[model samples]
Target: PVGGELASHQWRTEHFNNPWLLGAAVLVRDETAINYNWGYNAPAPGVAAENFSVRWTGSVYFGLNTEYTFYATSDDGVRVWIDGGLLIDRWQDQSATTVSAKRYLTEGTHPVIVEYYDRTGPAVIQFWWEPGAPPSPPSVQPFEIIVDDQDPGFQKAGPTSSWYFRSVGYKGHTYWTYNSDAQLYNSAKWFPQLPQAGNYQVYAFVPKQRADTKNARYRIYHSGQEHSYSIDQSIYFDKWVSLGTYYFAANSTEYVYLDDITGEPYASKKIGFDAVKFVSTAQPGPAVTPAPPPVTPVTPTPTCSIAPILGFGQVWNTNPTVRQRLGCPTQAEISTWSAEETFIGGYMFWRGDLRLIYAVYNNGTWQSFVDNWDEGQMESDPAIVPPAGRYQPKRGFGKVWREQAGVRDKLSWATAEERGLQASWQAYNGGLMLWTQTLGVFVLYNDGTWIQP
Candidate 1:
């Protein structure tokens, strides 16, 4: 058999091991062969030897129609696809290891893509292929099972009207549809029946026709965990795309799922529902124990604690109105309330029994009820009319005036309606009282000193 080399451009990056080949590339070069051993050193001037990634894409020529096995070896993660069919998918961090997958193809040129990343330590990667079936011993061939869309093992759900069938390619027939706007509106599941428990590489067949969705979502339920993957069906046709390998028990709980929801625009593309193949990599038999199931992560429930208060004691002991409205402190006192005030020492309190919240300002120990329900109505209500020569507080001023008896006595009577000084508010009379979010509520006396009521 004649041999041919691939004309490829390798895109390399110094960033951390990224299986997706994302981010900018640090080096790009056309190489005649896919072979490299940049051990403990950068492959290029700017690229890092470890914690880096590389992607090679090009076309390979096959002189004859036959079975060909593609091989890849890497220290960490790696994935390979030929003519849009993912053959090798060991995309994970691991020591130096090699993996290969064989596929039959006609005489022609086919596109190939290889992606690799090194996490740490010595870095290495190589790719090559031989024209022949993978050398297997005289032992029984590994067990392999494929569940077609028409098979009883293949279950489907959705409106019957949306389901359409086609007869062609690998499985003889497959189900396909236009992309759906609704989530998971159409779905198919492939449940395989294994004779024994073991690890298996799963693959989904993307048919030649009626499959055009760029984002086809597949889920594999194995060993109490569901792994998700998004495949572009438009690039693959009449080929089994690897969905990764997993440990599965010979039971009904493990299966493969495909849905119409691909986050694509409404009815813009076609989606194909076809067959799923499970190739057993582990030894088959009752004597082979199933791999331990992955540990389901446990999320810790959140908890909160209220620290003891020391600064609010002074204000609580001094003001009876604050003590009555605020009750016991819920949180500790802090210096300089927020970013606005210059005063030190303030605290927030809550009456759990009454469901009332209160706050006292540090400047003058002014009390404030933090009631959300009645605050809007109380502040916007009409002002009370003045009695004879005495004037009533206006707008928000009236609401505050009516609530505090001490304000009425100290201010005598309002001479005018509340006016705004930027974001602050004030009313005139025997004494001027200003209200601002930062100062809370306080009376500015003739001597310039303010008092909290």
Candidate 2:
């Protein structure tokens, strides 16, 4: 008996029984088999050649309490019976196909009878079942961060002559603007040598502005060939969006260029670009709890938001084709959430949960890793606008906290209620904890309270 929560069941049966025997003279081939030429010559008189009979016993006792999946290359037919009960009679002239059915039977030895005929070409019948529990669905490898830039070194592709500069920003590190004419085509290249050819996605901090078709456009290039795509900024103000994605072939150099550069009145207003990040199409290795080490004390750097270290409690999901074709484990269950990606030195310290899975492309190569986050914990609603200097967390549970030398540290933690006016706090020198709230900005003290400056 195929076990589980009894998802569903179907039964059908058909019989082609003739009430009249046609042409009685049956030639015995081996005393066990007889060849009766019913359609042609030498049938005794009064023998009917064609006839049909019907009997509804309601069921057949074939005792075949097993589930079966039938496949036919050209044409096929099947008649099944269980415990002498006629269940399925699906005999029809059809093309090659596949069908499945589940049957229940008594314990011990159960009888099963299946009459399958392949009419045209390739024919096959196979059955497999989970005797007790249903098999678990396949998993996808976790997503991983392929290329990252901390500062200084990460630069944008220059004009037809100069490349964009990577600069430090109030949030973290960002790319500088192109001083060249907007109409003039320019690009910024990361120059990171990719491991293989796969689906690759590019992320960057782009200054937001009003929608103008003639304004700046974003494009990616692999092996010097322009990839087809554009960013949509109709819904956002001046903020960051995952510029979208493109394909990168193996052993190829990739770069992103901004074209149709317009909106000068707006471009001159902003100084530099945002952070640029590139990740591979491969899944990240399993999450390993890093060994504890001494906390390195350092001055608190200004942070846009805090990022939390995630645990196994997180889950995710992605396109099935990405999972099956590219060997990416679907984030369908907890056991499969293994890979991780950490975005450091940015406006927000974010991490991608599934870094091990890669999506397969139509060209047989796998695409870059597509991070799938926990829907309930992480923000999945694409419509939710991000606040100033804040972009979407890569994936998984996001925690806003302070870190000192890669170790999690608290900078005077306080409850949401204690952050209001009636709060008194002590001051500690060199402990930089700048807290910016909706109303205004303030600093935190060792006593776990806020003091507005």
Candidate 3:
């Protein structure tokens, strides 16, 4: 479609600066493209100049499985979703900023959504897409099956004394029980549904908090035999502790079991049962890819090297490739978000050449992107893919963000990126997503209900 459907563009006013599309649309019309600079003017006849939102939904046809980067530049906040997956999410009050995310799409039509909100400034928003490198052909991809504590394959037996604890567990949650004798009061089992009989490497996830049992025992029922192993959960935190490879048939009878019996004086230590993973060791088939059709070649833009900065010594010194990707420090780190009106907490770093940026809280957890500049970025290798154009939380906040699929699906994809913040907290879709040492990662919903998982 050359022009968008008139019914797809919707404009609605939000008196409270709430970016969500809670009310009915006040203005609905067609738009050729999402390129606008309202410049302190109202977006539409009835829409307000500030504290208003617009949503554009339509189907986009993709011609290849190649990578495409969607760019969204807006003032205030903006979010974009492709095929219902959130790519760029920078739902915060700021100047005109551009954020982008890359997605590999097949040759077909995919649903695209763009949501924007202007708080109180020169409204500016432009959205477009650029094709990037094509995806590699399927190769010897590792075969792995992960069964989280919340998965259907996981079961808890014995006493109901085991409790759910929110931490940096495998899938952001774990079941814990006080250590006891081998009598077994609480036990958890993970049954694997394999595709075919083969050798698999099994591993267990140990969380960082509330897990202190030194002699946490595990039992693997496979090949009609029982294999026992003891683990010291206290030594490793938020890590996958391997339990060696084993042979298993594709049946429900074989399982991995763990009990709260470590013989370490009852109630003295906590035993954590998180998630289990099974990895196939089978060799992959041969790789085959047809030749791509020849197309007109264009000269690539040359990228320059980044010069070091005094303040970014820590991150710059560690990652050598950051210099190449980001040409130079455009300016010193500046305040992004603040705790008090005067106390700077969130800081941002800009690059001189491309539309890339890096941000960090006072804790030094960094976030980088080719366009988006919120949240966390941890990889150091240049070859290691950057967010490419996404916002991912870090540490505990990341744990909760990864676990809450339903919340993210509702708030991130279905609505605008107008997450508000209040008093040392970040808000999202009428819910609070903040982290603390005492409370860990939690979400406080508008209904006064709290969830930590």
Candidate 4:
């Protein structure tokens, strides 16, 4: 009789083989025997073996080393073997079950055989693995900066309203005023006081109909005086026009006022003002060199050993032996070894095991140099190029070497062993304290700045 329909036809019909015989007739169902088909079948259900074993050639072993999970519904049975040795064998009657196993094997090819049966529900089997699994690399953390309207010190005032000064009435609105001296203007007005001395661009929105007909005049008052400039050009009405930029000197007070003197009656009646905005155009001054504020320099709690390197002015050394001796290779990328000092010129060198490199800042341009040594022969001129400001020299040696008058002479070298001299140079003169590493160069500045090149 044929096994259940869910079983593979090939497995049910295939003959079993053993060492003693090429082919053996194995009874799948024998109700007379209580332990039928090696106790894999149930007698009450008219036992049948859905899977028949077959052997050929040498012993079969599915030599695999990885994760393998088995899934089956209603009833599931599986057995794993290596070199004719059973690794796992389970014959059970139960609900769906999932199992995972990992094993290692020899390099030679192996065989994998699985037998599964589903009595009343779905069945599935899958296996997967990743050899030589490695840990995930680190990733850069992300950040963001947010800015709002209130950050710039500006506030909005609602819809426009008309100010009446005299008996002049336009359209249905009468402009008769008891106070004749009060000037009639729009709702928008500049701040009564200027925040600080800076160039400011003012934007005003006036209706198009009024802007086209009536020529508008406006003046900006700064430092208690009205600016001589006037906005006489017809602006696009209902649109924002830069009323032009005005400069307010340090400690100056400013405001803006508008007057409608156009003789067209229709233009005067329709002229309405919307909003006004003020933006600063002042450039910030160079950062001030902060005074060394008097503070009790806390004596660091003395530790067992001093830090490996001293922090000081820029230092340059091309000895790979020194770099390795100082434990520099492991710290090439994260540490700063050299720095630029503001002096007759701005430039410095960061020494690495592979080369003697320099970072030169002439005027404001920055360039990098890579040095190539010809062993015992005379050294060739270093190749110079513009680097992406941050330097990592694992690829090769980089030296910022150029014969510009103010370039090479400016570098003042100090050693990691000379702590006092390094500290003095850092305190008095600004430059980099360089550390040479196998991967690249590291620079530390006197002012607590570090750069990797």
Q: Pick the winner on lDDT between candidates 2 and 3.
A: 3
Tell me the whole-model lDDT of each prediction, alpha carbons only.
0.56, 0.31, 0.54, 0.31
Per residue, candidate 2 scores C-alpha lDDT tens digits across 1-453 of: 133221122212222323321222232111111112233222233422233211111111222223323221213454433332223445654544445433322222322334443333333332223332222322433242323234443444445343343334325444444333445544444444655555445655553432323223455566434533333333444454454344466554566555435434434422334444454434332111111111221232223122211221111012222111112111111222132222211112111221212211111111121122335654333654444433433332122222111211111111122111221111122111222223232222111111223
Error of 1 at 318 (Å): 51
Q: Give lDDT tens digits, candidate 1, residues 184-252.
A: 678888999977777777888999999998767788787665655556788897988866566678899
User: How many Å off is the CA of 85 in candidate 1?
Assistant: 35
For model 4, the stretches where C-alpha displacement exceeds 4 angstroms are 1-188, 192-194, 208-211, 228-237, 249-253, 263-269, 282-453
Query: Candidate 2: global Cα-lDDT?
Result: 0.31
lDDT tens digits by residue: candidate 4, 100-142:
4333332223333343332323332322222322223223222
Model 1 residue runs over 4 Å out of place are 1-141, 282-453
* TM-score, per-candidate, Cα-based: 0.35, 0.28, 0.32, 0.21
lDDT of 3 by residue, 237-260 (tens): 899876655667778899999888
Candidate 1 deviates by what RMSD? 30.9
Query: Candidate 3 clashing pairs?
Result: 100-389, 101-389, 306-327
Question: Which one wins on TM-score?
Answer: 1
Error at 126, model 2, angstroms: 16
